[model samples]
Target: MKRIPDEVLDHIVEICNDEAALVVLSCASKRLRSRVACRQEAWRKRFERQFLQSNDSEQKWLHQHMRAKRAATHLGDTTSILLFPQGSAQFDWFDAYCERRAVEYRWRHGKYAAHRLTNTANVRPRGVRLQSILCAFDYSPAGDVAVVSQWLIASPRQSAWFSEPLYWGDMDTEDVVVLSKRQSDEYLVIQAWNMLVDCYSLCVWHTAAPHRPPRTIITDKREIPDVSLRGSWLAHRIAHSADTGQYGAAFVYDLARGACYSDIQGNIHTCCSLNATTDRMRIVCVEYNKSTSSPVTIAYKLWQVAPDRAEPMQCQATGRKAMSLKQGDIKLQRIDDGKFILYSRETDDLDPISAPTISLVEVVDEASGVLLKEKWSLGIRVMDIRSIASHDLFSIQQTYDKWLLLSLIDGSEVRRVHFNCWICSGLYPPDDQWAKMIDDSMWWNPRDDPTLHIHEEASQELSPAAIVYGHDDAITVVDYTGCMHRSEHQQGVERLSIEIRNRRIAERKHLVAEDKRIAAKRKLLLPEGVRMRTEGAHLRDKSKRMREEGEHIFTESMRMRDEDSRVYDKGKRMFTESMQMRDEGRRLCDEGRRILDECEHLTAKLQEIRAQIRALDST
Candidate 1:
């Protein structure tokens, strides 16, 4: 009501945390509307409560919560990840959430629409304008029709860079390995391994200016094959050359500034691992003695690539502080902060005193190479670690069939999950089935076939954290968060949820109808030539009308001018007469003044007589 205070309404809104309520209240009265519209602090509080405060930091957390919320809604299993339209902005929390929601929806409920690229003849299709697609395919951020294959990015409608294709004929699809591709509103950076030259090529292109050829830089060394892009910075490793005999180097390039920062070289064999954080990149390398086979000296070279402290590319070889390990290939896994897990697995025979060592996992500071804690082991030996999240390291021990997740910080076991099937990771396909998949034309589509359909709805009791699709097409997600299945909730919210869904459906339909109406109206518009002809004809008619009106206006304007001049002449004569009258009035006023002066003197005497009479009367 108008009588209700805005402070009361604001308090209610804050307590309710309902944007819809806020909208309704804003429309109720002008004063309320002003408060709602002008006050950004209220919106900030709402944003903090709805998005930030309730642990929406990690993508995994969002994925689990949204899915759980959807399941609790009692709707069908089809959950949309991207519930809202994507907002266009860089590093917006709301925009990120929208994109991530869509991603989660795609992973869960979205169906795949397959588009044929190459024809049966292993060439571009008849209507298609794109060149032949090369090796692997990577999708753009807006995962629609376009497929970025090797150097050429092709869409169903047409290929990008239509006039001048970016494809180099000499470069093979196999040779051009795409290391990392980063897309922003202003620019796109495709860092690919130029295997032909044995170097990494930083391909930068302006999305706004697609006609201009992309700027590219081929690294001087061929050994830096791998590249990782974090925000505007790119992290890469320098290849180890036998001729140089020095440890491999790590390079960091700022995409925004176009500056390169390299780390000092140590006795590195090859860059074993590289990871990029918010601002810096950590590179790990291994070094071993070439001569002595027995008691073989092994060490890891740790280098950091930061903006201010980055070593120059041509910096002299400084001896890197080595973290000593024994008898096997050393591997480094980067964790959160400047920490990493240094690990190696081996069967020892040379050490006579101590029992033969099986495996070792040690946590160390990535920057200083200092041991953080004593090595942690849970009886079994782990060969490799694979993880979806940075904090959770998933690995299968040498003796176990099931994969176990270990905390990166303390090397403590988080959980163990069994997988019936899994796809092997490598460049080469493991079997004929995988080889067939790569060759098959229609294998990549994510459809609801007998092979791809999950059909695990009946077993909702086993809450899954994620649903992973393996080589066999059996879908199963790693379960830990317990949100994969049906969730129990307080009663009476079903109707509310249904109402909300109905409202959304209505809004969507209205938008679609509006769009269609606009489109149809646009289509009914005249063609360019027709429009131009019509506009020209209209202009000509308008000009003719304007000319006729101008003629009439000109005639009227001349007549009025003549009348105005006659009136002005008459007024001038009248003004002269008035001036003479004013002079006569001035002369009369002077005469009147002289009379008034004499009258005043006489009045002074009269006043004196009156005063004397008044005095006599008083006496």
Candidate 2:
């Protein structure tokens, strides 16, 4: 065994592909143990084979595996005590990967229940309409503590319809938005517009004491005031009305210290848009300026707002630049670093012979101030976008039709889910027609026609364990807890597969114990063949019986291995078929999109021709 070549040992290890089998083989000799322990590549290969496929990048696969492992290790034995059990950390990252996929799949295909908040057919005297979902939080999977808000009500009370209300002060306001942090749950900030007073106020309340009066800041209403929060730092943009004209200013407030930096403003000139990093340490501000002479060429100013590293109290602005934007409603967002900000703007077709288009997204590097990523979406309407800071994942709501969870790492869509309303409509031509009608009409804008109110869904970190979304009156929770709620056929198949794996493991352990017992018995009760002179016949009988029993156990073990192999092969075939089906479905979706684009073109042409005929007749 010591003389065995490394190549031969490597081949054996690769073929076994099982950590338990490799461990047993390593114990056979010190040389083998050393080879296994020293070879990091072997462990990497084993990890990939257990969790990822050949097409997956080895680096990404390793990174994901390590991340999952770290998440499990930190949770410890309490992992199993949660509402959604993540299994034991010792079970390897394959278990974690399975759990992750289950969660994604549940969100992709799960059904949602909608609870209407207002009467669509009849208008009440109050004219209450669910304007927007400001912020949502779900801290527990057991549905213990939940907090969600529409433009009207922002509360922590868990009520189904519109029964219970904790904080209803914002309900009477025109526009309300909430910004809060999960890492620090002490502060809850609510910004609401009071039309009667013609003023906007920022109300900061301690979550522990909901009934208490909050610290407030009152100012005139602004057009697009943005608020961002991280840790104990809160940054916001205020639109202040003055004697000359309307202008905007950015401010930062330390909720912990109760220090407002409104007086010490330095370089932040204008505020068309404002975005901050997750740490709230960095802020990127977008300011648009039009020259008195050149109205056509509007310049944009991008400023990097950072806190003094040495002195946390002092804020400084270093990077400043200007660029010209041709057309669009430009929006800037600070993603992870000051070097890159998510640049999103909307552009419509210049010619009326085409359908109006929106939703163009890009990532711009501030060093050169150049757009790095090409426009991501064309001819797609986007309602909202949210980013998962830790995972580099972007969740997008595309035209109230579907939700796409996209990855910035690979620019690949991680998951796509059609809206439950559209799904219920069978996702057919009628649904497409209805979606187009909604897009063209002013139905979505409650301000235009409140009776035709439609609910919108956006991504929120409702809980540490779940990605929660709200639409209409219902709150949708996305997590692995829904895996047990699968169809009957799927549940049965999963149960059978688990049973096979458990049986194989149990049989292997039993066979090893039996072999050890037989060896011990032979050593105690039997003598060598040369020493057995008078009792040779009796010894032969005992030896033959022992050999037969050992053979029986070996045969049973081999049969079990073969059965397990067959089950694996069958599963592999099924997985291949599923992949093929998914590919086919994607192709169909692409084809449908193309057809819809052509139909829109034709409709626009027809409308143009009708207008021309009407003009000719009038002449």
Candidate 3:
């Protein structure tokens, strides 16, 4: 294996069946070790094959991974980080691959640290699980997001965050989180529901700079539900013409130049579903043909939207139609630049054989509106299609009890997790659900809306908490990013959990005492001769039982509180130590970042100098 040429070796490593064989091969010789494990090309291929692509700089992420391994050593979980012997460097590509692989496994297994939502103008999240999710708005697959019980907006592989500020506290359930296709993670459209106008006012926010105010993009008097923002262009639903009764679909506009490419008021208007895919879009249209009985048809057309000046919107049909849905649900989302994936169920209700089908189609024949590339995922009771990331791997709420990760690659359910709410699968219930169960009424402003199940199907179970957990509603923002920034906060979750138990016990005691007093007063009111001796003895026995129960509860509360105190003291000491170490880590990380930046600058400078030297040599 070591004697093979580098070109042959690269091919061998890329085509190697699995990582285990590669690890064993890497141990065979120093050449194998360098080529298979330490080299950039071999590891990059493995990284892409095994994990969700990260937008973070590979070098920076490598350093972060190194920091995590060091942290795990500090926390005494030394065995897991020791992937290889002395061979793994601080920022080796092999180590980077391993970290990403572990993170992916963390996502798959639903391993995460749950933190409650706090202010930044924020307190650290308390330890409790919040209610069920209404909707999740994800930025990337890296798990860097902000989740609210009202709505969920999550990302993956980074820290997740949500806020409860003055304005954002009012965003309604339908105003979804919209992320741009680019990796800057900037240019997300978050909406604020204005109840007075009964409309949603959408604003563009640079997600990284949350402390700054967002620039409002549109403020129409309607909640335009189907809005898509990609790169520099924005498309949404516009108001229809009142007099003509024509359909209305908002046109794309560039915010940088403040240019509107198409105006819907004067020209092209249609009741078509529109979603942006990079510089273009896949437009699906339905036409009702009068020639045949019950003749309804669906057609797919490519809609190319450019920032350059173009003629006003023109309504032109590519002139083809496909099968009409009798009763199930059909969803169309962008798979990439020119492709569209259609997920459909034959029946809305659950059936064993009639599973949801995913099709990758293009407008090859404008006549058929489909070039069928079928990938079928067989499942029952699919509640809704939540979000679809880049690789055609979509997340769906299966029976409203679990989030299943369905892949278009093999048309199978790759992973399913019951704990996390969304695609990133980072949000989870508190480590100790009862212990961390919180009363969040203080900040969680409740609204008197219609029923809880708004857009999706109503309750499958008749009870609310089964599908939509609304009791003790507090969210524990989970961190499965594994970047080593797990909060070593004090034992607030345990202490708070015990505190709630005590409150309930005290309330029970007060109610019992009040009932006894009422009974005694009523007996006195009945004349002294009317009171039976047997009745008096029975009342005495009941009072004694009540007293005994009260004493037991009091004793339990005392023991729990004592335990809570000891836990608090121990947690405080550990927390203090962890915080100190965390500071030291941050200081080191900042220095490392500076060095990396300098190295990048120097490398670029060296390249420029070499180019100049070549030019002089030519002269």
Candidate 4:
């Protein structure tokens, strides 16, 4: 066997589209692996372009054929209705009759006119010929039309077309510009025969202009990275900080400037959300230790953003002043003035009223720590407390005035209730109506047999649990279900679903037995286990039960098989129909061309005869 030349092997690898073949070629030799990896980008681009072109061509042919048939059948002028409210809800809603293209927008109160904004254009011919529609509509911060991008068909034959400029106006000026042929950041549209594949252009139009050329910013194609608007910011867990003793980082993205910053040193664990107050933003981080029973701890940190500066600086720790609180959760709500209300949860101790159960700390400065103004303790029975929302702390006059939702499990029944913090204790008696409501809501009924499980002499009983409310009235029940029941239910469901599936298999086997008799006369091999009828008693009994409940047991399986068969038949028919149509179209086009040629020849002969007659008359 002759060894292939290096150039030939390289060319084969370059043209190879199969991933498996490429993988094998990469392992052929060290030089081949390096060559393939280096040229991966080129191969990827080539494959993507080829795949997109073929896909677009098939899609375009189907669309154009369908549209032509629809247009020929329906004879009427289509109108698009642009509806704008007179005075009530300040918004614009467009209703296109023929194409069913619609969009709604809310108007800025005084900035733009609400009544005189209705505008319509003759889009019937355009819509009929349109193969695709490209739309980009986004409103600016002040409720102004920041951009509107659209592309339409220009002719009935669908041979030529143009794209409209990004319309930027609302109480502002409007602008339009014609697009060029070459692909650029300014304006360039590419059509894959019928469908507009892509439009890579930047049209910057201001709101204060009725007519003007959009400022164009062009860059080389190579310089543009594969950056999409839907792209996500990458996040990875780094090593734990030795200084702050936590595992986390701060993620900040500057949308205006298109830059991202990550602060790993600040010991940030969880970033709830961004606060848009000053240049700086706020993020939450958790600190924990394994030795403590309640090992998990949480804290909030404030970071300042300096646009001129490269990174955000940690200004201060807000939860530090509430030293008694072990930072279970912290919620920050911005209120009047430059102050923020901080709700921090502390460990509950007996004598709930005396012990500091919940703390509403006011953040003054990062250096000074938290200033605790109000403290509340429900009872010594309460073990843990957490703030549901930031507004929960500041809005309530008394700490107990806020509702504390709790979850309780009394050996059998699981109970969840939203009770006033002060009323959670048995000592505080409620009104007759409220008392009945509490009793009805409380767990009085048991689910499973209580006598089934005998408590082990050595094992300690699980403690009662409570629900902690977050800032948004969101409740988090601690250990909602005991480990035993949760595992039991999960296992039961898995077993049940599997048992039903197994029964389905048995029924299918029984059906195969019946099918085998029909095939036996045709001399087909009997599948394994199909002829065996009475071998195992247990298996026979199970199969008997399965046959009785076969309809319900194998409903899902039968449905799936039926769906598969239907899809296969549908695809086969579609392919056959498409091929038949294509053949008919080709034949018709050929016949039409022949007829046209005959007509042309006859017209030429008649014109020659008329010229001869004219010459005879003149003579």
Best by TM-score: 3
Report the C-alpha lDDT of model 4 over 31-125, residue by residue, as the tens digit: 56544554534644533332221221222222333343444334331221111223222111110111111000000000111111112122323
Candidate 2 residue lDDT tens string, 1-619: 8788988887776677455566777679866764554455556444444333311122222333344444334434244222212332233333333343343334333312223333211112221212112243321111112243221212321112222222444344333333322223345666554545655666665544433455674455553266665546677776544554655667777676666655323323333223344323444444544332211222233433344334443333323322223334335544343223333332322333322232223436467553434333233334555543334445556645556666655445764333332221111122122234322111111111222233354333332223344444444433322222344444455566568767877887899999999989878766664367547878888899999999999999999999999999999999999999999999999999999999999999999999999999999
Model 1, 554-586: lDDT tens per residue? 999999999999999999999999999999999
On a 0 to 100 scale, what is the lDDT of residue 348 in model 1? Answer: 30
lDDT for model 4: 0.35
> What would the per-residue lDDT of candidate 3 be over residues 221-299, giving only the tens digit for each residue?
5445446655445665565555566655555656555666544432122323344434443344323332433222444
The segments of candidate 4 whose C-alpha lies over 4 angstroms from its true place after superposition are: 1-247, 254-258, 264-271, 277-280, 286-300, 306-311, 314-357, 364-619
Q: Which whole-number lDDT from 0 to 100 does residue 475 have in model 2? A: 47
Candidate 4 lDDT score at position 48: 34
Error of 3 at 65 (Å): 9.7
- For each candidate in the order shown, give its overall lDDT on alpha carbons: 0.44, 0.44, 0.46, 0.35
Give the top-scoring candidate (lDDT).
3
TM for candidate 2 is 0.40
Candidate 1 Cα RMSD (Å): 34.7
TM-scores of all predicted structures: 0.40, 0.40, 0.45, 0.23
Q: Is candidate 1 or candidate 3 better by TM-score?
A: 3
